[model samples]
Target: MIKALAAKAHTYVVLADGSVPNPTRNAPGALTGKVNTVLGILAWAGTAAGVAGVLITGAMMAISMRRGEGSEHMGRLGMVLGGCVLVATAGPVVTFVFG
Candidate 1:
């Protein structure tokens, strides 16, 4: 049964027309300027948010250190640094994951 199913899967064409599958019939076309503008705005907003988060985290880390918190300060510093790394590599990470 497993072999028969595997054979069928290997031989199947999901679209009866045997043409390239286009799953985005209703999707926004890539040629539209509005899509690009919206995407750019969103990207900039995300970057700004990440910068704000880093600033806030740094302030918290400073306060923690001023209070003589060794471990907690280190943890906060690590978190802010990790966030920076993630934001910096998000595009590549997404591409790698999707591709």
Candidate 2:
């Protein structure tokens, strides 16, 4: 019984010390954590700004229509400009996620 108990304890000790190996740690040096944090924040910011641009464009169009005195052409132009910004922001987010 004592020998069995000792064997079990030894097994437990070995298993307890085993660690999960991180493959990233085995690779060549990569960018530091700070870079990742900054990139992540920038990605989130881009998405937020894109959504905000869309909202602003829509609001401008709505308000202008209600006023009934401004150029519809300018309102359309605002929408186009917002769409362009949204696309520009999307590119950064995609790269951040998959690259």
lDDT for each of the candidates? 0.70, 0.70
Question: lDDT (0-100) at residue 37 of candidate 1?
Answer: 81
Evaluate residue 29 in candidate 2 and report its C-alpha lDDT on the 0 to 100 scale: 41
For every model shown, what is its TM-score relative to the native structure?
0.48, 0.45
Lowest lDDT 10-mer window, candidate 1? 19-28
Q: What number of clashing residue pairs does each candidate have, in the order they appear?
A: 0, 0
Which pairs clash (backbone N, Cα, C closer than 3 Å) in model 2? none
lDDT of 1 at 70: 62
C-alpha-based local distance difference test score of model 1? 0.70
* Per-residue lDDT over 1-99 for candidate 1, one digit per residue giving the tens place of the 0 to 100 score: 999998777657555548664444454576556866875686677778778877887788787678888656567657767776776687677669643
Scored against the true structure, residue 3 in model 2 reaches a CA lDDT of 100
- The per-residue C-alpha lDDT of model 2 at residue 42 equals 76
